[model samples]
Target: MSNIEYQFSEDFAREMDKKDPLAGFRNEFLFPQINGNPAIYFCGNSLGLQPKNTKAYIDKELQNWSELAVDGHFEGEDAWMYIRQKSKPALAEIVGAHTHEVVAMNNLTSNLHFLLVSFFQPKGKRNKIICEAGAFPSDQYALESQVKFHGLNPDEVIVELAPRQGEHTLRTEDIINKIEEVGEELALVMMGGIQYYSGQLFDMKSITEAAHKIDAYCGFDLAHAMGNAPLSLHDWNVDFATWCSYKYLNSGPGNISGIFVHERFADNADLPRFAGWWGHDEGQRFLMEKGFIPMHGADGWQVANSNVLALAAHQASLDLFQKAGIKNLRKKSEILTGYLEFLIEQISGESGVLEIITPRSPSERGCQLSLLIHKGGKAVFDSWYGKGVVGDWRNPNVIRLAPTPMYNSFTDVYQFGRILEQSLAEFA
Candidate 1:
């Protein structure tokens, strides 16, 4: 119902809001209600607002624990033995993976290490890992630790592709060329599913293909991308990937995360992996045998007992994704984010003070826009936040506006744009 052909105005946004099919979904979230009014929350790209059903899902598990105790693992309603099983179908849909290819497990960083143990096998001249230069601190740390784990020097073995001088994005050709130039020595390429700071959605399919050309593994950190964008981990032929449920997945703060393993390595008997009892064949798990016979799919990578409460929270959120559908969310996302982009440009015209750092094409980005505030720094951003326009600020001078489709309305974007315009004028 959003008409992108016309210029965005307060009336235009209100009209579109009236016609939005997903408009009603906003109320299903448990936004902070101060004085009985929902706060204007525009931070789903960082942490999604909680679903109304989250407590119910968690309560089911809590009841099982209190009443059934150890028996809950096998006998309670929503049996814990198969609690993880019920989640796989919905998660597979979101990531475009086969049910066997995905598993919900430990937190994001832990899953990253588990996947790396299996796929990041560097040897001989193939000892380098390639990633974007300004990746999230956690990812950079993981890559550095992996390099040291392999007894390699971080500087010599880590290949960080950076943005061009005076530019904010890396062109596709630049990425392809980096793979080609370093493919021989590259052990793996792990990138953000959507670059956190700039909101760039890296072309995972192309990157996977390019990396495989030189027999290198490719993976992604989907902290910013999962649930915000449509993904095809299996179809893309990616070796492995991991994502946090806390961000776009809406599983609450520091919830459990997940991983995907392509079926190709699922049956590979010789694939290198760190083994544990939980990953071993369930039938033989209680036997506690010396030999570790792992499961054949992504479940094989899980190393310990799951945190049931977090998994319950994750299922509560993924249920919303299932009901709305990733493709449908993406459909609405294109309109909502495009509307934001259109309005920001309109308000800041000819000012030379604000520039968008993310790509213009919808395919190249996700729900967030990285605004490079020209004349002001974080102090200016603080002023906007003081006015109840909630957004994130990167270190030096960038304001990230993520108009998440599930909860954000055209009206929220319209208002946020107006606030940005007001702040610029007041500060200037």
Candidate 2:
């Protein structure tokens, strides 16, 4: 809870929009238009709108490739070979990590598998992994496959923590107790920093500390948390973390992902990993040496050459992130997302059809608010969608609306409220 008094009137929302420091950023994106106007795009938790400058960034690279051909890897303004290096500083700033600690690499699930290969070290009694019950499907698959690869049964080695009966989110105390209970058997604690379905932001620092106290490695799938929340991966002493760039980062869909490995394990030559030539030492990389001399930091986790065009798109969004400063963006996010929550409450007033599953505290969530729709389910969501309120609907009955600070505004959230009221009146 914040001190700001939220009101339901459109005038109040417009006033907030007028005062927003980040309001100019909304114009920087190419929105999905509705009836000649931009749609109420509260879906950054799924896919962010393209930055208006994305085309220029990508075109520069295409030009460089055409002119330089094989020499482009060394000669361009952002050389193909060093393209990942150029994006590292901004990425590090976004995630609160050192320059060498973070790298833009493969997609989310691929990075998860790669990180697990090195970090999910199960030995003797320490063979179990803990994750949330309804973690994103890809994470579930990665964890299960990793466990099976070790000749362990996922059912026996994977401990899924779920919310208590009738509860919407996991209690931090319960999570701490579970970590302590698992004690010697816990090999890794892997979960989302911000849960994808319920939009609950887990206490990552506390969770990391708890796991460490029990001698267990801790990591996060930060796909939903990356550009939406403030992270201190290095300060938190998180073991390793990975995230996709397409969501709140405003990178295009299926764009490159990012990874963070704490400084302690980054330079450890003895750490077992699945390596490739790109992860080789840059100087010796061209030698094609038989031995894989891994690079000293997160780059060592890379399995192939940089995805040039994908990186161009990613870098364009990261430039905005650098200019906007994550701390400032987070401050505005709290207010805008809070406004959305307040509006939802107003629309659902005394109505039993919809209930917010996301936490009420501003500190315990990102930009997204997940609504559990009890009646009309998909039809209610469809009505809102038809009205151009572009939120994401999950299975059974969850509609997630995220007013991303980088490009979303108070007026956008306000318009979503208007359409939501109409949707409920007609369907629920």
Candidate 3:
């Protein structure tokens, strides 16, 4: 991974693409139509392109629902009873967690709330939850509501970790320093695994170590990092984490998300969690006992029946993940994103009116680059879109372009760079 042998030339890029194991994967996705051919879609950070098989997978569930009546639960092509279980192993491989440690369940924010119920217990003088400031709005709301639900004021209970003066990204040292300096007052350390806006991949292992040192539980919002980067949640000793699959995992919009509960918590049968019938022991669930006997592991966290359509769509995308190993995807990501960084640099130099807010090092970031438009704002980005270059614009000045390895390629990067260069020229 040191100094990748990048073939920046168009011919070399095509030649490299010819040999890429994942080259054919691009065709498996349902592309957005643009003059018949697909548009240069580089917006996987916002919403992933749908897998072509997603519709077929979802249709199977619909077929069952239409034909099987109530018998679909036990007699369908794939039983609805164990629908979510189909995603566990694929998700485990993606996040480097044990299959027993993962479960496909509610959306990201909902799962965050559920995990917070069990993990974010604040007591005594240790009621503060430390997190990165300006987190994704849903995460922000979840944290605020959870803190306030404990009858604690958010202003006092939620400790925000911010970057230094005039800086856009938080450093590892700064975060660890705050955790250490906070001492025994921190009830939990919950932060984004990769900050959404800045695209910074935080030091999960070190952060967890620091939090545990002070007797605090550590958790992460892996919405932006789960499928984009390599994860070893179990080895890192992360207490709990939640993620959405629609973004980098390419599971389509509003798909059912996944959760990771450490083995320690999994084994803690005495732990407090909000339970439901779906969380009950499968063997006795049909017996409908008066008392709750929850499942042994992460399966115990589910509340209601599985979202079969969404889970099937998730399964469709995760099937691709299982084929293109996370390790392999991440390796290509570093290079693909590196190529993006390189192309963006050329654009910046040529344009002289754009700046990338993301880090220069691939190790410190993921597939995304948050580009700050200089002088020009949303209008410039709109112009780029008009030129058939599709990257997402976030509010006042930032544009987020993610060159995902699953489907994005060197040619796409080149096209985007060329569009950016021309767009800026047109503006000037």
TM-score of each: 0.97, 0.98, 0.96
Ranking by TM-score: 2, 1, 3
Q: lDDT per residue, candidate 3, 254-278, as tens digits?
A: 8888899988777575677888889
lDDT of 2 by residue, 66-169 (tens): 89999999996788989898899998998899999999999999999999999899999999999999999999999999999999999999999999999999
**lDDT (10s digit) by residue, model 1, range 177-199:** 99999868888999998999998
Candidate 2 has a TM-score of: 0.98
- Total clashing residue pairs per candidate? 0, 0, 0
Position 44, candidate 2: lDDT? 87
Q: RMSDs, each prediction? A: 1.6, 1.1, 1.6
What TM value does model 3 have?
0.96
Point out the higher-scoring one by TM-score: 2 or 3: 2
How does model 2 fare in lDDT? 0.91
Compared with the true structure, model 1 gives a TM-score of: 0.97
User: Which candidate number maximizes TM-score?
Assistant: 2
